[model samples]
Target: MILTGMIFQFNKDSGEGLIMSSKGATNEFSASNWIDTSCEPSVGLKVSFEGSDTLINIEVLKDESISIVSDNKKYSASDEQKMEEFSSVDEYIEHFKSLGYKLAKDTDDGKVRTASLRRFLEDGHGEMIITSIDSKITVKTMVNGKEVK
Candidate 1:
């Protein structure tokens, strides 16, 4: 069976790692199981693999980078023109849902709030990363690494 999950723990020296599947199962894996040679395994890297006891034929999945900086307000007029700001997190979430995207992950740790939405396409997938802190909301949407909406 094929399992999709994220690498929650990885040891570069040992070349061993653990995958936390979307269904909440934890599976161990090693470097040999990693099929993607282009990139090294690291924590928080999404992957797909086949196995039950030990994961094999591991493949890396596309993931976008998110940066939450304090100086986010320094955006120039051009930058502001490119950005899509929302009044509230709920409003932002609803906007993506209206665009046919489903909420993939969400986290709120008292200080920071984040929501990740995704839309699967025939060729590739689209992702949106939303972050809100101190009443400041930042939204970034990408399709196969190319920024869109």
Candidate 2:
């Protein structure tokens, strides 16, 4: 059976590692069992393996990229006018809150500020990420894992 998990522990000297499967089972693996030559074994790397006690045919899993589809609705003249009304990041966040979206994340560094808002959809979820850098603000939206511009 093929199982997916992350490499939680690895010892470079011994060429051995341990994988914690998504199902919570921990399995042992070694360099010989690894099948992917593109990358070396490391902790926290996602991988898939086939076996029970000792894993075999272990391979690293590649990250999936989200595809963005262009949708001009968010950039309509009325929307642009509304966006320009916000004088601060707080006001920008409040605008989305008024539309029933909830703040999912907020981060600020010395140079940049970012806020992520999310709302539940009938099928999946809708998310909007707003960023402010040097008094310039940009917005990106995604629905069901696909980004919509």
- Candidate 1 lDDT, 43-105, residue by residue in tens: 767677788887889987643211211221221223214446669888888877765557768
Model 2 bad stretches (over 4 Å): 1-85
Identify the leading candidate in terms of lDDT: 1
Estimate, for each residue in 19-112, the C-alpha lDDT of model 2 and write its tens digit.
7654445678899999999998997676767888878989875442111112112322233235545677788788877755677679999799
Question: Ten-residue segment with the worst summed lDDT in candidate 2?
Answer: 64-73
Residue pairs of candidate 2 with colliding backbone atoms: none
lDDT: worst 10-residue window of model 1:
65-74
Q: Rate the local accuracy (lDDT) of all candidates.
A: 0.68, 0.67
| Cα shift from native, residue 128, model 1 (Å) | 0.5
The pairs that clash in candidate 1 are none
